[model samples]
Target chain A: MRIAFTSVGTNWDAQIDPRFGRTAFLVLFNEETAQLEAVDNSGVQADAHGAGTAMAQRIYELHPDVLITGNGPGDTASKALKNLHMRIYVEAHNMSLKEAYEKYKKQELTAL
Target chain B: MTNSGIFKLAIASGKGGTGKTLLSTNLADYLARKQAVLLADLDVEEPNDALFFHAENKVITPQYKMIPDWQSDRCTLCGDCTRQCKFHAVIRLGEFITVFNELCHSCYACSDLCPEQALPMKPYRMGETRHQILNGLQLIESRLDVGQEQAVPLIHATQKYICELESKPAIQILDCPPGTSCPVVAAVDGADLVLLVTEPTPFGLNDLKLAVETMRQIDKAFAVVINRQGMGDDAVENWCKSENITVAARIPYDRQLAEQYAAAKLAWCDNTALEEALEELALFIQQKQVQYA
Candidate 1:
């Protein structure tokens, strides 16, 4: 299962970005393969109205089973994710990407 | 010298509710007595210029723009149109490409660059133009449909309709939208002169500076008109004095004018002081036409 975390930077040590849509980087961690990858989310800045929805579309394209971020997705994005049967957890803000992922693995983080 | 050319004057205010429509309606009404006048309300979002006059024989024309419409039967999820769209309007989701009409700018870049020729351009109605003829004045008001974000295209369509007129009016007063956005620029562009309507407050002064900067960058001649003069401080007056920008006219804060305006009545024409001010404004515009000509 791939878990996506909204991150401020491309690395694992980077803090989790509070904004889901305008997050700088989306760090994807595969629990099965123990593999980690970071995808740049710079294009979301160009979206004026539906940034959250567009970012959700990008996340859907990545095939992430779960999304972890500081803030919940917007109304439109949340609806899209619901249709895709993706679970979202909102917590672990200001924490590093690696710490957030480890806490999620240990079932320590709150599911929102 | 008799000025035979059409004088296009655009009334714009950087801040909303600064009496742009009030000034434009009265100015057009006063100017129509001597020569033919066309009052084009380019504030497509919420146009209220028609309220001042008893507009008769109204004609509504729909404004459309060609937007990319997809054909699902092409049988290929190649993602060519998605790659070509710069606005992110096209989204590819599990062998299906969805087009968001609101996000599309009607640039046709994706349709033109489509590899399989699946995307076709279709006419999307943006807004409607209402043409009305008053006693001696012609009012062309553009109304953008609700939930529509694109206003510049509708403004352009209204201008095109005006240009196609067989007998072009001697004076065209465009009531522009507030702020120095794309819609304001579209309405004020190619005008003979821009009359910036502003109040005497801090917000009005700050927005006026922005409007002035936009006008200067576009290389258009502009003059300031201070409305509700006594309600606020003299910041606008002092700024205009220091900048050497011409103060074309001033309308004082009158309770009667406000009440009449709320009732959709032309009370300015009845008041001696307001009528004289509007006439002087028309005279000033005539002098400017001769000077620019």
Candidate 2:
């Protein structure tokens, strides 16, 4: 199964947000091999209207079975995640990305 | 020019964690002592100002309309809606048409441009607002329901409650959300003055410039307030100097202030410098409003 993780609300890479533009991290992981590949939403700066949805679309295209991020599972993000058939997991403070993935592998992260 | 109308001030920054709420709410309390004030917390998502007042929230509801499910039998898949959509939210595949609700801005273009009569429009309950009284101030705030894409519509609805005020106060401070998005724009749109609160750090300076540009573009009068001033270098001050935006005040890093805010004790009187800064800001805004009038 293919898995993906997208960061919204706050960008861990830039660490600072301009608030005007879109910023999110998109990661793709393979459940069969545990290999991970991720990409930043390059179209973030171009978001003028429907920015949140634009970021959501990029994540949806990844088509992952599992998703991990800072936003809660109950946000508007769930709608986009649901489109891709992806399970959602909320990343609390102090939990690293690798640890989050490990928890997903162990069936610790539940579907939203 | 005699302080007759409401003095709308926006507390905003382009970035989060800039202490905009602390400055807006605490300052509101300081001014409310001698004058009537209306504190509008416009930050729908994660509004933390109420954490400072812990006031009882009365519900405020707003309604919205969106595209209703269309019948496929009458639809010919002419792709009129798809081509008309700038957001690319609507797609037509053979006989099936799917609407990406998240991508749609509720523009009504799809429904209006639909050649077939199959398209139906319906109302979607987007979100609701909650009003409360803190101290002597009427604190009105709105909360966007989870999964709601449109936050500005609900914010606009919250402002309707403010018009019912018996007498327009000398000061009305709006605690804006942390961003330069539509929600932030709605908060600062009709404001006469804006108080931008930011920290003294690279991230703070980086985001402040963007927010400043936005304010300038909108032609709104604004000043700067530096929170946690001594934590980092003087980049914020230098940037302010270069940008020509006046630094109205600076609040040092104080553990006591944090404790006070956490305890819901936003009213402050013992801090002389803090009191002086807010009072000065209030006077400055009043003077600016006079010029505009």
Candidate 3:
């Protein structure tokens, strides 16, 4: 299974692309191969819609089975993610990027 | 004295990158020297005043409800709300009526048009209004919940805090949120004067005209302040001259002032000339209030 997380920075690594204003982040994870990769999506697009497109493209790129965030359950951006066959997990509060995978392991995250 | 209480002055612009915050804070700081000033930051979505002032903060909780609190038993599934909604915020399929709360404009048309009266509007908590004391000035601010789309409710709540001020000053400077939307209207509704901040760029000129038209439609008193004055073309001044709106103040481009601002220092501290200009603006607003009186 593959997963992704949206955070303030690009990922836990804190790397960001400087082209477009670096304001948001996207991280990808894999369960089968235990591979994790995180990339900055701020440079990929502009505005909220652009952020949605960037997430969709990441799903396409990683073919993630799950995606997670602190919020954004029914927002337009999250709806776009649903279009890509990616399940969404709206966490209750702030959890670290590493802890998200642990929550997934404990089945605390919702599939949708 | 005919209620010469320095009326709340809302400084707004229709677009981003305008000097709305810069001008508002400076004006408030300047007015504080003579009178007690309350600077309301109604732009809850992106409250940057604290970013500029970095002081202790207080929060004011905002509460607002949305329309169409659906009763599943009474709902006929006629899809009336989905049909009437201009924003496509509602959808009725089969036995369920789904609502995307963020997209809702709270127009109440959906609930009013429902036949069975199944849809009842419910009061929902939206965001919070906050106050921060920065450098001896009362900074009234509002922060909309990260995902909440109801900015108007918080903006209105911000006004309530402004009304609670112990002593009204000769001037109340309001740093309004960007854009000429519902939130902007709520911010500028009761202001006696509006100082529109703008620049000479094409984008600034374009949005300034939109803001001016909004003010005209609402029949409010207003003037323009050209910021970063010398960098952009002269079209901003020309547009003001053609529209017969007063160009109240012009702030020249000074990299040193910009650097000082970034370093969290006062912009007018080193520039005595700029300080004198802002004082003249205070005097100008005083005269305008008397003229209207």
Candidate 4:
């Protein structure tokens, strides 16, 4: 499964960005390949309004099977991503990317 | 004032409850007795001008702005509309093309540039413009529908409606939304003269400067009106004097005025102090009409 998480930086140790919409970097992890991909989200940050929807759109394009972020997506973004075949887990705030991934493996994260 | 053409006057403020509506309502009421007047409460988010008057024979017109609706079959998945939208209102991922109404500016840039004609502009109801005669004053109140985020479209629609209405040779007083933002710009952009109302407090002075700067930036001839003259320090008046901005009128601090205002009654009749201030504002408008004419 390709799991996507909002992160403050691209590295594995980088802390998770609590905000889903205006997150700094979107880090994608492929569990089988053990590979990581980071997409810069400056465009989402610069968006004057509807950053929630924009961030959701970006994640939709990535085709991630699971989304892990703090607070999950807001109402508007959640509605846009409603039909997506992905499990959204939230409350991973302040955790490093590696720690969050480890916690997800252990079924420690809660679903939104 | 020479009445060669319609004089569009706007009442604006940087802070909320600084007497923009007070000045607008009274000025429109006072002036309508002499000549034709159109009072537009352009504060669409919270329209309260109707509260001050017993308006009868209500006529409401629904206001709409165009928003792009996706036609999936016609779309080639070219991503043209998404790329062209500056507001990020439209986004396409896989087969789903989503349109966020709150983010749409209704510029038609995306819809017009779409090659496949997949995105067509559709009228989305944002607000309502109500017209009524309030003691001979032509009162037009534009109110945004609940959950509508963008107010500029409704304000523009109200302005357009006002323009299309008959009686062009009157003084049009627009009670604008507070703050120097997009909605304020849209509301005041149509006015020839703008009356920026403020108090004499520090907070009032701070916002007054911003309001004044906005007026200058827009290149609209504007003057200041000091409400609650005796309450705050003289910073506002001193600043206006130093800046060479006209002090059109200063409404003295009167508890009676406040009491009447709270009860939805015009201070024009009950409070002589407030009445005189409105008179001064009326005079200033008359003089400005000639200048603008």
Winning model by DockQ: 4
Provide per-model DockQ scores: 0.36, 0.10, 0.03, 0.70
Ranking by TM-score: 4, 1, 2, 3
Off by over 4 Å in 2: A1-112, B1-4, B54-57, B62-74, B160-170
TM-score of each: 0.89, 0.69, 0.66, 0.96
The residue ranges of model 4 lying beyond 4 angstroms of the native Cα positions read B1-4
The local distance difference test score of model 4 is 0.87
Native-contact fraction for each model? 0.18, 0.11, 0.00, 0.64
Extract clashing residue pairs from model 2. B60-B129
* Candidate 4 lDDT for residue B160: 85
- Per residue, candidate 1 scores C-alpha lDDT tens digits across B42-102 of 9999999999888669999999977888888973878877776766677676666777777
Give the better candidate number (2 or 4) by TM-score: 4
Error of 2 at B174 (Å): 1.3
Q: List model 4 lDDT by residue over B60-144, tens digit each.
A: 9999999999998998888888888877789886787889988899989888999988889999999899999755688899999
> How many clashes in candidate 4?
0
- After the best TM-score superposition of candidate 2, give how far the Cα of residue B8 lies from its true spot, in angstroms: 1.2
- Candidates sorted on DockQ, descending: 4, 1, 2, 3
Better of 1 and 4 by lDDT: 4
Stretches off by above 4 angstroms in model 1 are A10-14, A43-54, A70-83, A89-112, B1-4
Select the stronger candidate by TM-score from 1 and 4: 4
